[model samples]
Target: MRRAAVGSCPASKRSTLSLDDHAVGVGRARAQVSDVGRQDDPNARVGLHVDFWTVDDPDEARRLLAMGADGIMTEQLRRVATRGAIVAAMVRLTRRRFTVGAVAMASGACGGARAGEPWSEEPPPSRVDPGFMPAPPAPPSPDPRLAFAPVARDAAPPRSIWSWTTAEQATEIRRDEVLFTRESSPTLGRGHLFDVLDARAADGDPAAARLAGVELAKGRFGWSNPWATVRGATPGETYGLELLHIEMRPDTWFARVRTSHEAIAFVDSAGNAVDRGAALDSFERVGGILFEHDVEYTGACATTGSGGGGLIYREIYVGNEARLATFSHRTAAILARLEGDIAELSAFRDWLRYGGGDGWSAYSWSCIAAQLWRSAPSTSRERYLASLAFATDPYAPYAASVDAIVTELKKASFFTPDDPFTHAP
Candidate 1:
């Protein structure tokens, strides 16, 4: 079962908090930082829906403390935390909240019902008459099909079609195969990424504009919408979308759509977004399509350092790798679905690589920076490799959270190469 995280606030720049109708009893005392948001709020769960998570080192964010944000998700928090004493104080206060919770729980020991503690005054029970109720009927025989009764050693063959695909058989088959996808995996947290995607797209409909609900509009392009922000993920509640494959051409600028996750592919001529082995329902759930992100010999992205359009992931639009941009014309955005999972990052990268129609030189693994491999952290580091392993086979061992991925990585006994932002490389 999924549980929401809640905690107190680190001594945030009280000024940054907005005491709306939702937050009663929270008082004001001429707070300091006006843009703190919930980054320093101890009560804010790390995976709860956020308006936005900014990455640009703006002077506006003077300082902050991280709460439940996974390591990959808390880069913003660390950036603000490094800002001298005031921010350090905030971090300290935030970490201290856990201690406070522990202390409170410890103190609660004395308030519980103990063996020696006296009970409240009890009342006496009333007398009852006989012959008031009837007895229950005899139990019925259990059905062998649905019941947990053992199979007879000499029993005849089962009748149901499912007998051919029993749980044990299914597990063995999947173990033998190297690849398989299921409806079980979910996009992190947000059930529908399309909901966020809608907020990010620029639509003319008055109803859509009203529903988009923006405090500040960024042209017709919903590029800068906070809700659709690009960042590491948390588990999504509903399995909103499933991207099977994208169609792209390696030779010419001209392209066609057909489907296959096996190689670079796209939708078919008949408008069928079908894959050989992928379920059609999952394919239709794709809120959008994905592309590849391969390069060789220092491409434009490596050269110019531009953030190609997509936020939340390998930004390529306004950077050196200008070719990393995506579009709805050649590409498709999944609507009303969440496709979040560290494991799925590879697919997204593939989508980026091929969808943008940049002439590929060669498939160079080194081009994919080490940082791209960094998984979501458990305690200190994220489990990027574990996620990739999960991506290879999400059904193999099941992923619980970012922590689960991290634990898997730890079990694999591999080293995580560090990527320092030295001189903004």
Candidate 2:
């Protein structure tokens, strides 16, 4: 693979290159074919585009994958390697689905896997809990008690989430939040919530089930009904949860969110989207940003830099800070402070390019910090670190990056050499 020098493309020249061989050759060094599903020109197609916002079911994943996609444009990249988890879920969905033709075969155990239902050859389940399709989502209470907060779509659906998938819950959120409506949910008014379950079944590893969801508990970090035994999971039981990207790319793994629709982002390297496998929960194109939250900001962090362990440079504040502003319309103000007379909502296309500026990872201290902040009554740096993106990597170089930037700033007369300078991550 190859890496291009940043900021090499000019705007005026864009009209000249739709699928430029030279540009593609540059990308070929890295073995990449950008789909750019979120661009302004709907007519513009570089042979493909991917955005996880419209889909959140394993069925959707299967569809995209069938389409021969290279990569899913999603934030949840770690779920791709969940073949093991998928196997476990299939076992639960169809007991026979786990036999030779199902789980055993998918695992490459040779003779065990035969030809039948839930086979690796078969399609993934799209809809679970037929009756519990779309739940009532949470209302955007816009409570002043917190800073910048987003309520869950199925936070309190008219019906119970007991038989609903997290995708269904997410549907509710998109529909109700006039500002956040989606094709999946037409109701237009509700919030969706999820729970996380880590339970064990008496016979086998329930967590090992395919398309399975110990599922997440609503309004809380964990689950309420710990176990819904296979014997108890009747013909119509609803279940769903957001699977967090525990690691990105090279180490694809998901921490599994106890919430709705986070799973939709999982796609195989072949670009084959998995159904009911993962679901897209959010999509907003306010700033020409096909920016991926689960993709651009997975739950990973840097071990050798100022940001470590899930230490994604992406900062989401509950309060009205410039960080949230960057993701919000406030983004307009901050960029205005930094650049020239560029003012359309699409200006974010330029900011997206700035991603080279920072990064974080899951299992890192930095990720821990982010969670801590989101869960606070009154947030702080220390508390944020508790559940943030800082990595346990021994050589966190926030100081190093700071020093380099400081040196440049000093040279530019922004600060005097002797000035007492401090760098914080």
Error of 2 at 15 (Å): 26
Instruction: State, as a TM-score between 0 and 1, how close model 2 is to the true structure.
Output: 0.17
Model 1 misplacement above 4 A: 1-184, 188-308, 311-408, 411-425
Q: Model 1, poorest ten-residue lDDT window?
A: 98-107
Instruction: Write candidate 1's Cα lDDT for 250-342 as tens digits.
Output: 111111111111232223323344452342223322222222222222343342221232212211011111111221110122221112223
Report each candidate's C-alpha RMSD, comma-separated, in the order given. Answer: 25.7, 27.6
> Which candidate has the highest TM-score of all?
1
